[model samples]
Target chain A: MAVTGMQAELTLGPIPFHWSREEKRDFYARIADEAPVATVYLGEVICSKRAPFFETEIPETAERLERGGKRVVLSSLAEVMLTRERKATADLADMDGVEIEINNAAGLLARAGRPHRVGPFMNAYNEDAIAWLARGGATHVCLPAELPGEAIAVAARAAAALGVEVEYQVFGRAPLAVSARCYHARAHGRTKDNCQFVCEEDADGMPLATRDGRPFLRVNGIQTLSESYVCLVGEAGALAKAGVGHLRLMPQAVDMVGVARAFRDCLDGRKDPAEAEAELVGLCPGTRFSNGFYHGVAGYRKIAADAAAMADR
Target chain B: MTQAELVCPAGTPAALRTAVDAGADAVYCGFRNATNARNFPGLNFTPEELAEAVAYAHRGGAKVLLALNTYPPAGKTALWREAAETGARLGVDAFIVADMGVADHVARTHPGTRLHLSVQAAASSPEAIRYYCESFGVRRVVLPRILTIPEIRAIRKEIPCEIETFVFGNHGLMVEGRCSLTNYVTGQSTNMDGVCSPASDVEYVRSADGSMSSCLGGVTIDRFAPDEKAGYPTICKGRYLAPHRAEGYYAFEEPVSLNLARMLPELVAAGVHAFKIEGRQRSKSYVRSVVSAFRRAVDDIRAGVAPDLADLVALTEGQKETQGAFRTKKWR
Candidate 1:
């Protein structure tokens, strides 16, 4: 848990979109074989209706990643409303040989007395809350993506003191909110119960634009994500210095292995942070990039490094 | 019929007296600080005002619930701790809290005080609700504005805490306490600053073509036609363009108020212990009229008669109201 002299581990966060089961299998197959991530988070973290489609393939995916020398973790849904969702989360607690990442409090209650990771959606914003979760057997916690750097440092220090590892989202679209109503289904002129799984049509998620035609967010079933990918490749050193023990890269419909490599290289000091940022941009064409949330500005605003450095001073 | 308690919003000392006079079983208010969600300028109660308001509500045989609901920023939880300590010292009936740190502080420091989980906590499932009840001794949970009545009935059977539902006011479609869209656009968030679409950052401009546009943080959130009435510039309620849609539509939710006055008996039968109203920044007349209407509705339900729900449109947002997700599962 010591911040200094500790190499930050690169982790692939759970996929939040709805892709085909075969596509998911192929994606994980490539990730396991080629990605340089130290840990892999699998399972559905969005709507429960989408879980059954991929549930059968999870064990194989986990096994393949484990064979590739990666630690596999299963993530619970962010919002658990249906009874079946609750049951599925409780069932995950009994799964052997893998840790669980709890996005909802229901998962925490079900996995009582067991070591687990608290996902970003659980809202551990302060030191006291992080300590509380650590007391409840949480070994790691991914702080919310909207937090600024100072807050992250404070929480990271508290977690480090409690012997808990703190992870921060460094790539992919930041998940901003989750709701009971499925916006994707509603957009398709269907109800959530009988929508026929139309979210599968958009691999990255359906883009939401402002009235002026500015891409503002992406709608994936019940969750809303920032339109721009949150790229902290430029701040790897700063984040590590802030005591962040892990850098999480959420999976998207891009060259994820390349994305993982860029982050891995940047964190390992094998490549310059600016060069890694350029490589990431080239990997995901036509997507905006942002690191403003870390600078305590609007999430969509990308502050220039020199300006950010001056502000830090 | 079982009687469900009516919880009304008291934004100020005057509003507290007005709600109590109009027959509120309990009034919920917040200190004038960032600790509460309705942290608007010229609204909420000062510490002295809150102390006086609690005394006034207690004198009228009603309870006061102080909302310390906003998540405290890191390394600055003293504000929330002070609010809880002040509320406990002033003899408030319960503390409506959202953050785990605030809840833990209140539970540990003021063990005798009741803790009601705010809707902002978004505890939708029984396991999540029970976690709060078991972990922090939360006595009741203001259920999120999402669950259907059947879902509430199922949840009530599973958890050991009282259930509270929003009976009237803002129909927030987004998950409470989790949304950072405001911050994404305006660099301020309800979870951190207790303000969503802060009024100072809102702008309404009348274009030369006779159309109107509502803007937030310099971004045009929605546009209104010459014949259409403009709504407040909340990020969630605005119309937005999406793929495969020609025109902009309400991607999240429209500007509609939630009016569940007709479902009182059904909610009571579903084991709802309290019905909460959602406006703390509304006028004193709003506090009085809405609280009085629900008060009579509850009484009429107990008397085995149909409750009247007319003349509420004038007070609704955008002058439109819906039952929201209370009676249906297809609200999206």
Candidate 2:
């Protein structure tokens, strides 16, 4: 059932970048005090080597967010390759009084029979997979970023029928792939084990450019992300109408609180879609925005909402 | 010590026969459709071809593993289901699957059928492997090409099912089944359509300065000098410039093939049950040479003798090879 006004919830996804412990704490502190998102996902979803740096700060951050009337969920790694990572995932599953989001299958195995959320990294492409995950105690599922609009609508409908909430990534650089070999270390001519944690230097990520000088992708240690940010402020109403329960906003090195407000204004119909797009561009200046994956085109192509509307007419 | 089975690729009936004749313990092939990962045109077997291949492998005491590994799109799962049913009817030795729905279908509908989890599932941990073993009765899991021998040994001790690792062919450093870089450029995805950098959209351009470049979907992926060997235009192996770096380099991975011929003994000693060779789209002669070389290496290890390392650098992608995360976790 689609409500008339602001029915879809705004969720802040876990930070995929390698931010320092203090920086992470400060970001969440700002988010808790200011951002209008309903849920805040915490914990390291990228490299496990960076986990201990912020291990002590996770609880405090989650507590602060909960105190701010926001629901907190601990997110697991997108890829579990080492033994310690597996143990850490199992430990996350064993935690009490906190919801968990399983990004990989190891999390599902560790947290089976318990209500949890499935992150975008775990493939929930088809209805059968969605129903299977729901039966295994998944309360929420985020569709992958590459899914077209029609597939998203179908998956959202399937989730509704299975009594599961469906979430979609609406902002930031889409995480394309993750690997065990650290690209940041490789780019710096260091190995993953002795890399000296070089990824911390790049707050957002190491921007990769094509040979011809076009910015193509960002190498964030083990994860590769798009150079363009996925902005769907204009599609919030259509997404909500298609039964999407939440729009996940990925963290970037920008004014995320302002970004959240822009999305909220657009979703609530307080700002015109075109104006919201312009405001988003102004907020994150010099960032390329794309929603072509949602439009069944190349992911880098930015299809203007006004142009689409006029074409339909 | 149990000799690790040699699992080889077979894109056609001829390749299947060559692999079996060359001493592959099991040959994996897929039907001619998007239901399988190697869904390229002029590749893969039809149902009748698969039935004959299965029979031929059975006669030679080799196994036929049907690969139905692609993730079916939402509301379009009947194709995968039909693939599984057809594979079962043709008496495939096992069904290699990646999607949970396909695994569930094979496990429920075809009871007593052997299920091997494809590497596309990206299950690396003991908990993840055990979960599949517990839920779908998966007998084997093709491990992602991202783990070291020591890590695989640790996992083998903890999980319940058998382990399979790639010993040769394309080093897909990116996490399998989770990558969308190809889809971002080409609108077709490996998970959804079993295609990555589809041949239809690939282009090779020769510059006037005696240099060549490979392009995928009109985006230049990599440039090679006349003296250098150019590789397939996969996005991961592309050379790119970064702000932190001055010159262009492979930001993700270099164009190299995984050659674990020297690490076969260690992998076998680590309790790995199978060694997979990655190229189903290759020619029959390529299959024969690789399968035969690995077969001798596996046999030599089992016989307590050193494996005579065959020179396969010429057959490698970009004429380069690496151990690739098997000897160490730091190979980028």
Candidate 3:
């Protein structure tokens, strides 16, 4: 790969991990100043109860991100429909100067006849659903993390035909699911009502190991994520060829800006995807990277085969 | 009003017959695929078995609902579509689906076949329920276990579809159809792949303190003492360690059963159309006993008699049960 003008648009996905109000504000404030990401998704996507903590800071943070030259989008709760939660999401949809991302169909109902981005939580598996959302005023759609490349390519073509930007999770541990119950709290021996906000203790997420004692997953509050961070650095070429417009890197506890910059560098041809993977490893030590899901294999297969080769050596 | 419908889960034809004989109004089963949430191996029905089960249910005057509740994996959608077509051809009373794609497919391809939105769809709100009714013609929405009675009443007013609430069995606290924690650790999604913390990935190891730890996909989801009874290895109900807590505990949900038999009247009063009992993988004796008890309770309610809520206690998870979200938001 040679240096060129290619640019990998970075999207900051909604923070899946729960944090205190101050911690969340501080994270976004730092992201506003430092992250090379393009969009900042603000909302509590996991449990509806956590929304009250930082719901007030969302507008200010969206403004701050906008002020920092980043496009900011307020996201609807992925699992909406509770009375208070629905009202909260409705109020968020009513927020001004902020584009909204419809994580669930509730967003479509809330933002009826308004433009919004379709969040990855909504299943847009085929062109029909993608086109349906687009017709319903979706300008951008982040494809689900579980989608293989074939589906992505088809979705990209559909999105392009409808003049919508298609995004993929190019980094971070993929958010696998959101639940009404808090896994972390239950793990901590508490029910969701009395969870004591145990999720705040883990900055990134609590790493989960397989029965054989291998790291396989991470549980953060009600949301569960893959243990291995999905590194699409090696798939940049394939992504570009597939017409994916934006690469989303979920915000982690560490150097997200550097991670974004590395992806940017790789996309710009200043470094190889291999170089980007090396930097990603150095930036987030002890983390494993995999892109096997993109190639329609296991989610934990690393595209950079040399690391596995290195282990053999 | 007619006596409330007693919806039961049938893991096999024998269980279906057992439930029907025990006073089940309708029996629900799933084809052996990711389309249904109970994709447990050796469970569920094959095409021939499902055809046989449907015939048996109909002959016995019990309606059969085929579950195609899991989200269809991308690019492998034909499997779900085929399941839907086969279900319709077999003359199932309805198709219980969770995914929008699967629902859409069934609604369009088999217009005469009734569609019930699976709880796995997570359509918990009136607005969401309305969307399903309008878009895919969802006839009934199986309410997730996280709703209060008031929430159910509110939904009743907003949607045109009938509401089915879970009254017994596994009282899951998580949003249905959307959870992936099990798949993250076990390489299978409960909603899409229909397996959660699959047995192949589960391990039971004896700890140093004479306690046994239950592991899922090589990770300790929870542990129990030598005298303590361990629940099945599902990640959500597993105990984990946190910084503030010294002892590892239940990290997802308390190991409990959703035995809302006591709240039957309240749910029926709240415009609920049916009551569901959850355990399909259970033994036939368990099904016969639970179904008969609920049947008596429901009959008592119809006859204006206050039924005693004992005897069912033995079937409760950990010998304990709660009304769950039907009581209060604070009920844990």
Candidate 4:
């Protein structure tokens, strides 16, 4: 089944949860020492309220990752609403010493004409956007998780033509929305300002269920994520063939190092996709795996393969 | 000239006419496709209808702005470009755009066409608004509903372009252009597909107990008592259950409409250039009633009279309204 010669690299996405400083420090240390990821993104991509806690640890973590021979990109907030958030985005854009990835429209102006990465939150959905961002110094782009495999293939091709690298999240709970209001704080009968770091209690984010008692989503401060982790292990062959140069694995509470190794094994043809899928299920025992968004179906469903892609092949 | 111009929505030609006759300075409508946000069936105008609508609005001494806001999907941007060109050719006053590519194309191709940055761009900060203004010569920006009055005042001092604020209609609590809660449960996307909890996929089941449950796709968003009014199943306004609250609660936001009817003077004092009303999918009578009421309110404020707007509450979602985020940090 592994008939392609092209190999895809793996990237570690930023943590979407609010973990303690020691927890974050230990995670980064392990990643620097043991994980097989090529690039690591560090930042508070969700809520501005959670930024103050771990913002100081970013420089140190980036340095540690750099020592481990990994490319480090500092990501700006996915939603830049507050005045202080805008200032922080501008300040990060002005820093030329480190590579930066901008997620919001606020960072686009200052970061223009210089090299930077584009996060999925920017919604790089079409070719024209990819081409436009390329002109504005976007050397790399992590396409949004909602895009199907066919759409991603089209975007990857457009990005490849511009010499821009494309990264797709192949694992981790997909981020569905970012709101100005914090659901996590609201659940505890508290506002975001007085959240009291309530989100820190659930290291993997608080579980949210539908009215029918079906577990559907995870609430992490202002961000709403899918209950099912996006697992595109089955599509690894097609993804590599589609010119997707890098596969992203978002940071979760699971054994991410093992998860990275498994995906790397499948992409590198060292392990069968089914074998890797089994390993993923073992590593993330609490959640189900879904490839629905990749198959042009509901993001919560677990479709096996793209029938349209199979027909085309 | 009045202190601020009022921009109203027109889902159809009749609504367009209704908005103008009700004292709207400008009316915004979209083509019947994914090029705009409210791309529902039986809503929006066709190209020919738009030409007629523009002519009719101009005859009534009002400007018509065409919304081409939704982000075009990968490998399929031509539809959006053609829509923009057709709107420009039809003599629409301005184009409300969200995606940078569409804005870029409009700026370079139709050099003098006025561009208003849609709230779908989610550019809430002054720097973000400035980026759009400087990059594409955007004349105005529909500020996201996530800002406070003071925050809006602070932004007004920094940006180079005119700012438009929503004074009535849906309490859009989510940061626009970025939220994807609808996409997870339903296959349709608000950003790319231009539909959120699309009507085709929504179902309401009545319980044997005379209560009702609203479902988006196969998942239930909220349950209602027999006497409670059922609203559209917007994912953000849905009730959900968590460990902290065994009983379900409105985790993101409740089903309430944003009515800034009482705060007109303060918004005008903040140097707002336009007041926006956000019901593109509403009925003709709704357009007539709401627009006329707001019309009187705007005029009353100008005449230095206190406007009585209590009657407008009967038209809000859940028959309830909120001055969300504008009054205070509802959820700091």
List the candidate 4 regions with Cα displacement exceeding 4 Å: A1-6, A306-312, B308-318
Give the CA lDDT, 0 to 100, for residue A288 in model 1.
Answer: 94
Q: Which number leads on TM-score?
A: 1
Can you write out model 3's per-residue Cα lDDT over B1-332, one digit (the tens) per residue? 53478899898888998999888889999987787888887788889998888888888789999998877655667889889889989999999987777777788899999999998878878777777787789899998887889888888888898989999988775677666566555556575588777887878899787888788766677778899997787766766554443455554557777788778888878888899999878889989999999888887777888777675655574566778778886643
Q: Which lDDT tens digits does candidate 2 get at residues B254-328?
A: 778888887888999999999999999999999998998888888888899988775543346456789988887
Model 2, residue B136: distance off in Å is 0.9
> Of the pair 1 and 4, which is ahead by TM-score?
1
Off by over 4 Å in 3: A1-8, A17-34, A47-60, A94-98, A157-164, A182-202, A205-219, A225-228, A286-313, B1-3, B206-211
Using DockQ as the measure, which candidate wins? 1
| Tens digit of per-residue lDDT, candidate 4, span B1-332 | 33688899999999999999998999999999999999999999989999999999999999999999999878779999999889989999999999988888899988888999999998888888988998889999999888888889999999998989998988876778887777778877889888878999899999998878898988888888899887668888888899987788887888888888878888988888899999999998988999888888788778888777765655574567888888998645
Which tens-of-lDDT digit does each residue in A74-108 have in candidate 4? Answer: 99988887767888898888899898989987898
Lowest lDDT sum, 10 consecutive residues, model 1 chain A, at A1-10
- Residue pairs with backbone overlap in model 4: none
What TM-score did chain B of candidate 4 earn?
0.95
Per-residue accuracy of model 1 over A244-279 as CA lDDT, tens digit each: 978999999999999988888887778887888889
Q: After superposition, how far is residue B265 of candidate 4 from its true place, in Å?
A: 0.6
